[model samples]
Target: MRVTEVVLSVGIGMLFAIGTFLVLRRDLVRVIFGVIVLSQATNVYLITMGGIQGVAPVVGGHGGHGETAVTDPLVQALVLTAVVIGLATTAFALVLAYRVYEEHGTIDLDRLQGVER
Candidate 1:
């Protein structure tokens, strides 16, 4: 694999690790940030799967040269869709967290659990 791929892979791994750590925390805001980080990692992973070495998928974009690999448009579309969905999901999660905080007066998972019981 190329250096770029290796670097990106490492980055994705780091993101996942950080996300997991944050998600495991007791704070609701941290959990939401974790979810966002995880989603972003997924997006990066999807983009890397599409391959980095390629010309844009456009008519005559290769400068009238010989056969050349074009980056997958489907991957771009999928990532775009994922970004939109991730945004919506994050918004919903934040709203839910806000409501929970307002009702329970604490965003800490432990405190919330105590209140629930």
Candidate 2:
């Protein structure tokens, strides 16, 4: 694998690790952020799946022999779609967390779950 691939793979792993840790926290906001992190990691993995290219996949692109080393366009499109969905989901989660905070006056999961008098 290339250096770029190695770095991205390591980054994805780290993001997943951190996200998992955050998701286990007692704060709703932190859990939301963790989900966002996990989404980002998934996006990175998608990008890496496209493979690295030395040139664009166009007519007469590179090598002068009509040869080209283009990355998979479909992966790029998928990553873009994932990014937009991630943004929307993150926004919705934040709104929900905000509403929960307003209603219960706390973002902690334990406090929110406790019976209220």
Candidate 3:
């Protein structure tokens, strides 16, 4: 694997770990951060899997070639769509979180769930 890929993988791994930790928190804000981290980490993983190794997708993209060099566009398109959808999900989560806090008066999940008492 290339150095770029190795570094990115490490970073994304860290991000996913952090996300898991944040999700475990009782605060709703932590959960939001966790979701965002998870989304980004997932995108990173998808892009990393599509790595081309010293090659750019377009003949005229970053690594220009006469015409012979080209990565698959379908994977690229799918990644883009996934990113957009992830963003939309994050936005929706934020909205829902705000509403939840408004109704519950506290971001703490433990407090909101009365079964603990």
Which candidate ranks first by lDDT, i.e. highest?
A: 1
Clashing pairs in 3: none
- State every prediction's TM-score relative to the real structure: 0.90, 0.85, 0.79
lDDT of 3 by residue, 35-95 (tens): 8888778877876677555355544455444545455666678889988998898889888
Instruction: Give each model's clash number.
Output: 0, 0, 0
Candidate 1 lDDT by residue in tens digits, 1-117: 689988998999999999999999999999999999999999999999997777788856466467778889999999999999999999999999999988989899988877553
Ranking by TM-score: 1, 2, 3
The alpha-carbon deviation from the true structure for residue 73 of candidate 1, after best TM-score superposition, in angstroms, is 0.6
- If candidate 3 were superposed on the true structure by all CA atoms, what would the RMSD be? 3.6
Worst 10 residues of 2 by lDDT: 55-64
Q: Over the stretch 1-117, how does candidate 2's per-residue lDDT look in tens digits?
A: 688878888898999999999999998999999989988888888777787665555545355576556677788888899999889989999999999989989999988889454
Q: Which pairs of residues collide in candidate 2?
A: none
Error of 2 at 40 (Å): 0.3
